[model samples]
Target: MIGLLATVPALIAGIRALRDRVLEVAASGATVVAGVGLLAVVLLVIVPSFEILPKSARDAERYEQQQRLDELDDIDAGFGPGSAEEAGQEMQEYVDDALQLLEVAPRTMRTTTWSKSGTTAAGNTCRAFHERIRLGDQVDRSSSAERLRTAWKAESDHTSFFERNGVLELSVHPAAATISWIRADNQLIVESDCIPYAAP
Candidate 1:
């Protein structure tokens, strides 16, 4: 009977050891499954970002380009010469500077003119002279506008004053500048000093 009792204790210890080993294996297997699941979740999130990265980069590039264009538009509005002759001279000077900046000669440069009738506070007749400077395909209008704006900002102190018929207008004391983007021709139309011509 004493020998039987000793054997029973050994049997209990052996059973306990087996139970502990089984529990350890189950815990290890659960941990492995959970780790694999976490890895899968991470991949699911990461893979889409990789696919979207290029598109996000493209969007950022486009936004920057648009910002540059808008800034150029604002800058274009600030240039104006006091008279028709001065307007012509100033336009040529601007074109020359723009060509230097762009490193390209315009295929063609042309000007058009018209007269608008206006009434003054007094009974005198007033005429507003409008001039449009058109540059040809050799000059990229958008780039030229940007360069011209930079040059104008450096040379003059002015700010955006108004908008009329989709054209942006700016004033510098006795002179005014009108800037418009011609989408169909991919050109820029700059009307300078479109105010009543006053004789000195």
Candidate 2:
């Protein structure tokens, strides 16, 4: 009877150990599954955010904004004329004079592409090239000479005055000092230098 009792207890202990092993395996499996689920959730949330699609979208938006800014700058720089007839007249007058102030007018005009721009000066709204100047039919030579002198001043005063007076708006700088103009036809133009045209 005692041996029988001992055998019963040994059998119970064996069964209990088997049950605990199964429970431990189930717990380890649950832990692994939970960890995998969390990893999947993190990947789903984070991977798309770093993907190329969103980054490219942001880059495209930035490029569009930059283009809009350039267009606005062009508008502000005075590249358009209010009236075609007036633009033509301005171009024609410039052709006749050939910018005597800057002998480079013809050559520079030939070398560089001309484009229309707009600017305001002396409270008058006039359409002209930002980097070029074309005198009105009544433009005084002394006045033009004075303009040249002011531009060639040893100090940077000429550049400041040019902006303040609206003599020439330099949108595009050149290798050498340059003058720009337009003809009555509203054609854009440039001159390398106009100091030679100034009166001695």
Candidate 3:
């Protein structure tokens, strides 16, 4: 009977060890399953809902919209009624006033022909006059050139005589309340072209 009691205790110890090992295995399996589930949540649900998703496509659409708006603004800026014609009329008046000065250039400084061309914008005008002064029944070139210079001095507020590359240059700017010019052999005068005509 003593031997029987000893065997019964060993059998109880073996059953308890087997039960502890089964419990440990079950806990480890549960931990692994929990970790895998958490990883799945992060990858499949959380990542797809992130705000940064689709950011590139949104930025591209915004860029395209801005480009379209800029093009429309450019097209609308040039569209208007009579804007072109009004500019033309104002420019012509400015040109006509400037031409009057050429008509009145010293009567002795002969001009073979007048070729005037110019453009006006923003209430300003630019003119280019091509003039030719030919000797008129005068044998002495110096005396003839001097006579013309004297006449201009009498009528102008500024007079200057100089030579460049052995070519004589006499420039005069008469006191015109409207336009101003520098004249010599040929002339390039720059001043406001739209000012009201004032007799020099």
Candidate 4:
């Protein structure tokens, strides 16, 4: 459209130059109008198609991620309250299964504990088991982060998980699981806990 519009002055100049030759003037004017009209029609069709393409691609990718997360959720739903060692084992298995499903390897996988002084959803002083997985150099950080965000959003529509200050959090029910993710440079760090404190 901009290109077509830019040619208007040139078209007017050509028309002015051929004003004495009525036939030529009419032909030139008609040609200019027809060209611009064609371009407008093409832009109308092409521009909207390009606009919708990226959104459709993102939606399809999100659907695939959601399906994978649903499978993971099915596995997670079976877990019951247990000792720290048992919860750690279950969280490890969850991470392993997720890695397998995602076809990505972690640079480092370790266990840690998150402690809080306040009472939790479980009616106890805060103590949670965490399994941290760090993506290796082999992974594409941006793409992985997008996929993880999509999966987390699909699992639960909670808006807090999408906040962009720094950390992203995911909480699962029944099992009291919580997952926190932070992206650093070219790596994505994921912390998962089967035994999580209540939201505070």
Ranking by lDDT: 4, 1, 2, 3
lDDT comparing candidate 3 with the true structure: 0.39
Q: What is the overall TM-score of model 2 with all chains considered together? A: 0.27
lDDT of 2: 0.41
Q: Model-by-model lDDT, in order? A: 0.51, 0.41, 0.39, 0.53
Model 3 TM-score on a 0 to 1 scale: 0.25
Candidate order, TM-score descending: 4, 1, 2, 3
Write the residue-wise lDDT of candidate 4 on 1-200 in tens digits.
56556555556655665675657856687658756765675677557878798899999888866665554454456554443345455445445544664567444433344432343333333344555565556666566666667766776442235436555566544344555556664332333333322234
lDDT of 1: 0.51
Q: What is the lDDT of residue 13 in candidate 3?
A: 49
Model 1 Cα lDDT, one tens digit per residue, 122-169: 322334545565666777666755665565556555444444443323
lDDT of 3 by residue, 1-200 (tens): 34334444544444555567756555555545555555566676568757555787798778866665554443245422122233233333333333343343445444343323343332222333333443233224454334444443454345455544524433432311121223333332222222211122
* Off by more than 4 A, model 1: 1-107, 121-123, 158-170, 176-184, 188-200
Worst 10 residues of 2 by lDDT: 191-200
Off by over 4 Å in 2: 1-34, 37-44, 47-151, 154-200
